[model samples]
Target chain A: METLERLLLGHPFFTDLDPAIGRILVGCARNLRFAPGEFLFRENEPANEFFLVREGNVALELHVPGRPPLVIGTLGAGEIVGASWLVPPYRWNFDARAVAATRAFGIDAACLRDKCEADHHLGYEMMKRLLPVMVGRMQAARQQLLDVYGHPGT
Target chain B: MNASVAPDPMLPQPWRVQAVRRETADVVSLDLVPLAGAPMPFKPGQFNMLYAFGIGEVPVSLSGDPADASRFVHTVRAVGAVSGAIAAATPGTVLGLRGPFGSAWPVAAAAGHDILIIAGGLGLAPLRPAIYHVLANSERFGRIAVLYGSRGPAELLFHDELARWRGRLDMEVEITVDHADPSWHGRVGVVPGLIDKVAFDPKNTVALVCGPEVMIRFTVAGLRAAGVADDHVHVSMERNMKCAVGLCGHCQFGPDFVCKDGAVLAYDRIAARLAAREI
Candidate 1:
């Protein structure tokens, strides 16, 4: 749809100057929704999809061996959700659950990856943009490990 | 480094806990009033050594409005033995308070410039008084943008106050939690991630950061990359403290003592020192 192409190109992350490239990206973008408490992806699953949040929050959680799942971070509107797909061993590192009824522009990572390889320029641009997201997530994870909030008990 | 002008910075005065309000699951804000003599008032970004009856003492920054000298405030997280004891104490309980010490945030010097306040976890408490000063004198400062982040939605402090600040036309308040549950409808991510969403004149901005040292490091880097000068940025540093005065050298950060020289200092002053955690 023309509107879909417009929306995809309008995203801050996807300010494609080339119309042909925009069309190719729009081809992989699908409008997807997740119900409250529904998972978009589970940990260790194939990381074949990435999302541009358009409506609600998604909690990215990791399961502990003897404890309940620990949510490492959450993603909301105007933010990109999955970065594991960009790296090899393309597997979801954490379970992403819909915090509320959520709407997003989901891009099938497998299809996108194939296209990016076919066009190295686009691949480089895409990687350049996604690098910050990956680094931000890593830094956030490191901060959590520091337990900056301090423990509740003495 | 702004040294204390107190008559005797070492003496502990009895300060009564007038009220205590729970800010989060693990933190509480205590409103304290001196039992007898009125010591020197606290400046924004300054801290007091709060001594729980027989427990011990820990430096806590004043979290109240600096303009209201009647009762000072300190938000305490139950991080260790002494801090936990203070957080658990009753309203009528009396504690030993000493030295409203440390360098103040550049609230006075930052006039006519945009203020970008970035905080994380319990760091917001130290910056809260500085925020109040700006809000109280709205015309003196340009834009006031505050970005705060927590471990999770349940860990966020000052929910109601955050809403009120966000409601103000003069202040721009945005908060993010590292993680969230279904009930949370706000932004999610680290504190630094929210930097791109707000608008401020980078060249004319005076940034104040209070967070985990790593968060502060990253934030300072990001702000500098975005055009803020090293000297224009300030950070409230946290180090272990024994004596509220400079005599015990327990809270030394590189060349300076945190209690006397600064708990708050310009980023450029100790940028290299902060990079080395053990120093």
Candidate 2:
């Protein structure tokens, strides 16, 4: 628990936080593990939760008809997964699959949202911090799609 | 009433072209000597707008060492009339110079953090200074990694410098090309594709990216996908500018001015604008 607390504090999403707030964030998190080839979440699913990777790898898979599940990008330990929960629609844009056996700390989206609403500072910090991460991820996905693999007949 | 336009002290001091090195078929490096007594002072990642006699001016990054502020080095590719003229200038020719403008790469802040640089084509030119700054202050940083991509082997800039960077134990350099001929034996792919091959603790890493708008957009994504924070990712932008100052709206990216606000900005700072096709 102490080690997890340290890891949480170390993450950019929580780095600027006070230890008390960091502890509160850690307390709200639930640890989970997924084996390789397991589904963490599917595309278009209601995004009720977000995960911070602790170990192993996960691939953000985009499925197109008559095409393979293209690996748009991968995320590893210390990174946040499922950022769509921050904005409206609260639905995933891509499927997330475990590329290797993985461990992550899951935060209930509803609960976090409730806490954020109750404490605007927490809300401000989280959004202020996570917004860029979301944009960066979206831009990266777009880039991958525009890369050689994204181009037809490459 | 008209406000007087004061000469910007940050502008490059008048300099004479000392020599030119054909780094590759397309890229040429110019060594400039100050016309006066001393060389211009410029930080890494800042650029100088070079003016050819009758031609126009173009922003070119300073590729030389920041530690030695006297002699300035510029690496250029012939992409436009002004660029071609500047590249074609013979040794000892005089060229009008303005600016070592824009904020530099945050080498001081980057101290103790693992540094990752991703550059594409001419984008590598701006980032070359940051690479030199880090290498000169080698002990101040953790592992340093640079990933550069170009159209092909013939277009790769700083071949000798790339070789030297590859040889350093403290540094990691990766080169990729969009297309490769028979002579090309290295990795062949977009620069973003190479992000996964390097290992850096995103929690302790800061990434600097400069390249084409498309490449910069993708590289930021790659860094984030690799777990790097948006705030930790810094990017240098390329936009058309008639004036390097903010008064000219040509280089606008959203509410921010790429010329004054930044040619270099944190990924998070411009993330929203970057997501849009046009702004």
Candidate 3:
């Protein structure tokens, strides 16, 4: 459907793809829903799935001992989550929890990876689209750490 | 659907600076009159570029009321060359002006909602016009709160106005300093830390923020944690600008031009790009 194509093309992780590749991406994606407070994934878990939120809120939480679980950031509709699957150390770095009842489109990373290997054009399109999202998230994490309260002595 | 309609050229009529006021040690407020004798219609949060004589121009927010469009007003900090010149310029100086630019604070949309304004350092300049708009149309909104943080008392802009704002019965104003002097008898810490001390219903409130890049990032996070929605958090972004008309790539932030698309954007619209460095 055109709506699915529009949704895929609107996402930052897939927005810049070649139309053919975007159509291929839409074919591989499956919509999934999570209840509020549901864990989409846990830290150090196998990051085999990447998601693009279609609706509702999700929180990216990082836990440190003595310090409470800090909500470093929140992702909503039109945002990508679990991007670690694209790069090495294919493991989630933080826990993603559904802040509200959320509906997201889950793309099997291995499926996409397999498709990429089969079609280098799709691979290049996906990579080009994903690079900016990865860089942007890392910058946001760094900014969060700077804001979090910590010991001045440390 | 005709989604890409041409912009209404009549809305953002341009103006030129007729005079400049040195508001404080480092801040200057300009009084602008339209070059074409047309009224310059700008929403409160919009900004414009002021081109100096020899030096280039920079984007400065319209600190004046949007309802009164016969003249435009801008308060600028002397951060660099162009701003320093504008701050020192005498009255009757003219500068090239090209807006009432960018997405505006959703004042009409924010009606019936409490308004929270957080400004750090010179960030107050952009948010000032919004504060005036809200206060002037007080019945349209609920409680008003302002949280401001600066480098120190010496660097705080609008000290007298802030004092007056604090005294108003309809609004609550809190002032903080990143580093304070012995004489600075006010809150001391980052603006985010002050969020816990203030009281407002995030659901019924819309927040408008402008400040240093670092401060904005932190403030948005703080607001989110306090239960504000991304769409409801508006921010005014600052970047180096050569042309305020969006032709130059100097003010590009991801897919949007900070000049034309925004100096003010919904926090959600810019959150990802703002998080990225060198974008």
The candidate maximizing TM-score is 1
Better of 2 and 3 by DockQ: 2
**What tens-digit string does per-residue lDDT give for candidate 1 at A108-133?**
99889999999998788788889877
Error of 1 at B40 (Å): 3.4
Candidate 3 docking: what grade? incorrect
Per-residue C-alpha lDDT of model 3 across residues B107-180, encoded as one tens digit per residue: 77888998889998778888887888899988998888999987656778877889899999998898766543
Candidate 2, residue A87: Cα displacement in angstroms equals 38
How much of the real interface does each model capture, measured as fnat?
0.40, 0.00, 0.00
- Provide the RMSD of all predictions against the true structure, rounded to 1 decimal: 3.3, 11.0, 15.8
C-alpha lDDT (0 to 100) for residue B5 of candidate 3: 12
lDDT minimum window of 10 residues, candidate 3 chain B = B1-10
lDDT of 3 at A17: 65
Report residue B32 deviation for candidate 3 (angstroms).
2.6
Q: Write the per-residue lDDT of candidate 2 for residues B1-279, one digit (tens) a residue.
A: 011122673354467999999977656899887687666567778877788878878888888887875688899877678988999988998987777777778877999999998888787888888888898888999888999987667778888889988998988998876544323445545687778667789899999998877887767777777889999999988777557777879888889877777788888888998879878
Tell how far residue B182 is off in model 3, in angstroms. Answer: 2.0
- Model 2 Cα shift for residue B258 (angstroms): 1.2
Chain B TM-score, candidates in order: 0.96, 0.93, 0.89
